[model samples]
Target: MNKRSLRTTLIAIGIPTVYAVVLRLLFGIESWANLFSVMTVTFLFCLPTIVGALTVYLSDASKARKTSYRIIAPWIPVFLFFVITLALALEGWACWLMILPVFLIAASLGGLLGGYLKARNMNNKLSISTLVLLPLLLSPLESMIESLPGTYKAYTYIDIDAPADKIWRNVTRVMEIPEAEDTGYLTRTLGFPRPVKAELNYEGVGAYRKAIFTNGLVFHETVTEYQDLQKMVFNIKAHPHEIPSTTLDEHVVIGGDYFDVLSGTYELEKLPNGIHRLHLYSYFKMNTTFNFYAGLWGKWIMKDIQNNILKIEKQRSESM
Candidate 1:
């Protein structure tokens, strides 16, 4: 590539980094990491890349240099992703890394879209208009995205070598989960509570149980359906302050204002032999502008929690 093209690429790459710093300064570090915040930041980053690619093609650069520039365009935003994430981490904002993939994907896609539009000989006036209207468009688009109703479920099942009856006994009231039994990379990093134990006050429908977690977070579970060894349904009642956060924003916690652990169920199906299929299901709510992305992380974290509990129950029943 020619020196001119190289300079353009470097400037394009630096745009997103500078944008991120300015965003942090404007919104503060904590507010800069939400779904809307990340999306807006990514959109702003894409504008420069789009404008940069257009500038390269419209400039006095040679045909070969233009071709080379288009080829390397996508990486500009990706490079920005790494640089911006590193900056956030250095500032003690590593929690933003959880959505690193989102930012990277957004950058890459935006760069490609920008290049595609430029290649179509789209009027520069239209491109400039898009940049002007894009921010205005995002506010309502985000609301529409968040307003879209969604009921998401996470299912995890394990085949235990124990009888359904034994598994039921263990499932109804899980014993103390030792600290060693609670080692999950994501959960540990997010500071999610580990289940200590569970207690039931009654036996049939309308019964109440409390599953305690680390850091004083407690879930009040009220049984809705009771079918012995077959199905158990319960609703989740939780308080936010009891949960901890890895960031200054407590909204990252599951029970926070924007996210919730709605309800859960456990089902046991006796197989042809002595084994049982223990199914753990969770239904959650995400009242956020980025439910799609939030739901992804929510399912992962819940799946980890479910598997941990099931693993212990499986071990306990097998040992019995």
Candidate 2:
């Protein structure tokens, strides 16, 4: 390539890269900021000369003077120069940032080639590599951004075999396994421990009383709402771990639908065979206001509890 052409390549590719990395460093305490940076970088690269050319091309319009692709000719080199600069700037971005430049370059070049094919009215085989790639990268960037949040609700249709009334009987009824297979800390630690039966205080309002995990993680959770067996909302005021966060003013979680730290609140839905779906959605903040003290053992205990709930439910259904 000639000296000017080489310079054009570098500028077109490098500036946005640098801006992206800098913005990422500033905003990315977590993955949230990185996503924003990715979008900014993409937009800045695409907008520079292309948008400007489109703007100016439209602005100076007269009946005798025509707006044509020839006017956009100068923008081609200017746009490519900026794109190279943007690409060079991206060297500082995270490892993931390097993937976009090549595709973007091809996309920019592809547009130019498409314009060539348009006027000639000939079968021009467009570079499929660029055609299929730039948008794909943009898609993943958007997807990762949408996934940053802690939790959200998912809706799906499920047909249950049993009637809502019969399902409600099974769901509302908490099983109490009196004759457990095993005995104390050992019983709770190892074998089958007695099941402490739980029932909701109100039809669609208060706690269903959550499951009893081996660790000191049990809590009385109240329902936010209940529509027979169709749905139930509840909050868990759980001490997920035996220990607490080492901070001043000590994080204290109170029991109620909304005010609990270590405790997790969620919803459950039963549809029309024997199918039930659980929704673990929460819109709560975690600051020094309530320190989370999830110990290693506590995490294990919770996992076990979650798994065991299925087992307990299976046993209850079979017995019934």
Candidate 3:
């Protein structure tokens, strides 16, 4: 690549990288899973196209628009992958592998659009207009997405050297976990409430239960399915203002309009000889353009919480 071409490439990559760093590191933006971040992703998608077209416009004015597309098409993914790695490392985010495909697809579409605009000699006008209006367009899109319906699940299991009956007691009601026992740094850092103790108010279907989390957040659940010593399920009740934002930014709450935990399950299965298997499951949904990306962090956070509870249960069950 010529010096000018190389300069265009570096500037295109650097601009987005700096924006991301500011959003995530300085401003404490949690994840690329939010609608605002998705808007940023859309910006990144269109950025390379503009850069490519501008390169042609400046350097080779008569170059075919297809040539610009061809030169920049492959670099879109390369540049994005670099940004993803940098973000993941700096922010300790999740699911880069899965989010990569979404980024690639968005970049491809944006690059094609940019190429078409360049072909029609409208690249500059369109690029400028899009940059100005994208944030505005994304606001309503985020709202619409937040209102859509989606349900997802995460599962975690452990084998205990004890009987099913022994494990059931701990599963039904987790005792007061000591504050030290709660390894909450992960959730706390992300502004998610830490898991505390859970209390069950009666037995059988329609029974009431409360799962108390840190930050004064509690989940109210109604027993939907109950079986003695084998399985238990609870349908989550709508709990308003349950998710708190521990960050300076007010827009990153994982609960409320952005995401919700719908239900949860705990099960114990009898295994061969002197052992039992315990399973924990959580069902949730996120209303965001980047649901796929958001789901990754959701699963990790849920899985860690599940493992914490199961570890306590395993220790208690074996000793009993």
Candidate 4:
């Protein structure tokens, strides 16, 4: 590459990356200056847009004219920012995985805007400066707005060629699950702890149960309603303090400040074909300014965990 192109590449990639790292470090501090937060709309949405705009604005005008270049070039630096944060432990893999889609899209939009300004030969310097400083100015205001907690449900089911009684037995007290038996695609892909086993002392209302997972994560459950071989309802609680810090990212930790699982239910329905359909569902809460997006991931993760357990229950019940 020529010196001018190389310079454009470095400026496009370096400036945004440095800005992201600075913001990340600033957000990590705990004090009155808490406006720079990682969980806010500014960080998740605006920062990436600035990164993209800067990439296009700083690029050589000739190269920026290509429609494909405008869209894809910004992603390189955003991806580079992702790698740097993960490598430095500034952010966790799970958190990055969740925000990656948003970052890429916002960056592309920023690039398009940059391309437009370049084509018009607008006052690019002033515009780029404003965009670069936008997050810093907006985050404090965004943080001032209180995050409202929202409750959501993730429901899943599986059909088993077994009697209700057989399914109930497995549902009430799950045996130790072998690693090979786990099939939670999303959870496993995101590095979430896998289900290990669950133990219930008895089968009735007010019964105590413990659901164990890998990496020392545990869910304490108390039966609230019960119908023999038909339905079971339990309140689920996971103490963030009890869970190892390495098990989950703090931003998405179960029972943490931002997200939690509230309860779970299991119902068995006998179809006329003499098959039992086991229904599993869980209620989860998310307290974030961006619940509209975070809730989607929350539901997906809960369903994956529930479906994993349901699959194991189906196999075990059918084998009986």
What TM-scores do the predictions have? 0.72, 0.32, 0.61, 0.97
Off by over 4 Å in 1: 1-10, 24-98, 113-133, 140-146, 183-191, 245-251, 289-293
Top candidate (lDDT):
4
Residues 200-295, candidate 3: write the lDDT tens digits: 987689888888877767878888999988889998754555444432123334456656778889888888887788888989887655556667
The candidate, 1 or 3, that scores higher on lDDT is: 1
> RMSD, model 3, all Cα superposed?
7.1
Write one digit per residue (lDDT tens) for candidate 2, span 225-257: 766656665665654243232210121222222
CA RMSD of all predictions: 4.9, 16.5, 7.1, 1.1
Using TM-score, give the best candidate's number: 4
**lDDT measured at residue 29 in model 1 versus the true structure, 0 to 100:** 45
Count of clashes in candidate 1: 0
- The TM-score of predicted model 2 comes to 0.32
Point out where model 4 deviates above 4 Å.
none
Q: Which stretch of 10 consecutive residues in model 1 shows the poorest summed lDDT?
A: 55-64
